[model samples]
Target: MDNATAKNIREGLKADCTKCFGLCCTALNIVASSDFPINKPAGIPCVNLQNDYGCQIHSHLRNKGFKGCTVFDCLGAGQVVSQVTFKGQSWRENPKIREKMFRVFPIMEQIYEMIAYTAEALSYDIPYALSDKLSAQLKEMQSLTKLDAEQLLSLDLVMYRLPLNKLLTETSKYIRESLIAKLPGTKNSKNYNHERADWIGKKLRGKDLRAINFRGAYLIAADMRNTDLRSVDFIGADLRDANLMGANLSTSMFLTQMQINSAKGDINTILPTHIERPSHWIN
Candidate 1:
């Protein structure tokens, strides 16, 4: 796909709350933990969710003990579910559709996430065949987002997710080899148990971790201060509470807004152009 098309796809994957019905806050269940302070069942609106679909605690979710809310990103699935799948009628307007809408919300979220990853893969300077495959998959997934509520609920997410995951891994390998293959002490991100004993509190200071495969790694609270994170593949990595103070992530692949929200960073942290430094981060 062309850069313009890729840009459009990326833009479409962002959550636009104004066009949404606060589906993430309502449709998904929340377990009481460090991430949340309350147990809320699925299909139930959060106590802080207002009638207009805005969060009553939007500005103070973290301070109000709702860290999970801050970290959840629907990747533009909310609006598509609210506006497209349901034809712009919210469950509030048509109360009969409430249960169905709730069920479709999470399913649509997975589809959008797959589309987001495929689009990201297409943005790379990879081989023509790989780009073609990614572009085709991106189109197929984009079409899936337009499916009706019942259609979405019937989907086997693994079918789509598995192929996308494989393609992303291939893209990661290419990017990693081209950038850091010759570097000494290069680490394999998937070899978590053998290489790194644990996830939290890992202080990888002064590490040349370029083009590392951090996909699906649990990096909760891993200290990454002053690290150059360029060419890092962060797809599916658990970045919750990971310290990124002064870390450079300008060229990191598959890093999402939700991951950024989950992590701790500072003003000195260099993020991608599309990712804004969280205001809640240390200044």
Candidate 2:
């Protein structure tokens, strides 16, 4: 990356990080590994993390079993939720506020994901005339980052789209129509609302469903026996007690740290999200 590009990325990271407190590492658990020494529970602190909220093993996280840490990018998501929303109080400092903290974290994560796409849009040199509107939207997003847990969850963030919806639509069309026009082997995939399905007892044994979108799918008590689900989208899926024996989700999309905490899976269950895989089960 060029210096300008690198600088921009750094600024983005700084802006976002200023609002976060490495909550992904602190609020979540990881199995014992060379990277993370202790297997902690959700709402519990890592053994190596300092009381001041800095990682005791920050320098050597990679040398430990935390090789996954290097690749995991909250994309400035963590910092934003941590500092901006919570007002500099970390979950570690106030254990009594765990539930509220956890609840808000995922919402902020979603907003950050949207911001990431917006940042990418900006980089393509969005029209100079529309630049002022984009700047205003960016400011609004930044302000939203400062909301508390309940406030964030209650706000209809979609409203921000009202001003730039048409512009963004045209911009997206330009990208898809111009840069991505007629690209070989680049077929756009379709999304399905396979919700409320009676997957109660059906055996989905060893299915190759990589990148399949399963948002809001009702998978209650489903027998997902060893499915290959890398990078699959599960944004709002209801997976209460879903059996995921030997299933691979190494590259799943929208599998936030909060959602994983809410779901039940064993070691044999492959997870694509960045949180540490729990250690209780064996493949």
Candidate 3:
């Protein structure tokens, strides 16, 4: 998907904490780390979560050593559970439903994430036959998000995501292969297939890495500064602390907000238009 598609999908799929009941703060397990200052169990609210379902230290979350909260995007699942599945009933107001609501929150998260990926896949200029198949799959998954809390809890997320992932993989091939054939001097897609690569802390700066498949790669803390990352597939790549300063990822495939949030960048780093540069990034 292009940057426009990314922006549009994100406008819809991005988190709206205002409409949520602090599901991410309450329902998910948290461990102490550089990302978080304390341990919090599942179904328990964070110390900073207010009674009105807002984070008391939201504006200063990173300053308060809660960097984990900043990178966690629910993909609009929190509101869907808060309003649709449970019908605006909060764990506090209806304590009886608290455990079940917590259980369904994660399930909804998976579904929403899958839906977001499918929507992104449909934005590609692939063949009509493939587009129709992707559209159908997208609709099917979208409908599942409207199911009741009981139904959502029972959903086999892994089973649903498996088939959708295959479709995404196919779409990735079509996108990368087409771009590979277009970029001058670049070899075939197979020549750059670095799928599941282990490149932790590897220095690869200022390289012409067009159309490379870095899917499922361990790119953690890798020095990728000023590299040409256009048409690179970042699906399931661990880019934590990766140095992306001055790099060009304007046409990268399968890139997500979470991935962008975790990595470092600068004003000169050209990102796909859909991703807003993080405030922590250097100017």
Best by lDDT: 3
Write candidate 3's Cα lDDT for 1-283 as tens digits. 3435644764478788899999999999999999999999999998999999888888999999999888888888999899998999999999999999999999889888888778777776888777777777877888998999888887888888888888988988988888878877746434789899999999999988878899999999999999999988999999999999999998888788889889989999998755778888899
lDDT (10s digit) by residue, model 1, range 1-283: 8866786677566789999988888889999999899999999998998999998889998898998887888888899899999999998899999999999988888888888778777777888888888888988998998888788888888898888888888888888778765665545543322122346677786565677678778788888888888988888788888989889998898999899999999999999766767778999
Q: How many clashes in each structure?
A: 0, 12, 0
Q: lDDT, candidate 1, residue 281?
A: 94
Tens digits of lDDT, candidate 2, 43-66? 555666565556676666656655
* Candidate 1, position 182, lDDT: 63
Show where candidate 3 strays beyond 4 Å: 1-7, 186-190
Candidate 1 residue pairs in clash (backbone atoms < 3 Å): none
TM-score of each: 0.92, 0.47, 0.94
lDDT of 3 at 63: 94
Runs in model 1 with CA error above 4 Å? Answer: 181-197
TM-score of 2: 0.47
List CA RMSD, all candidates: 2.6, 9.9, 2.2
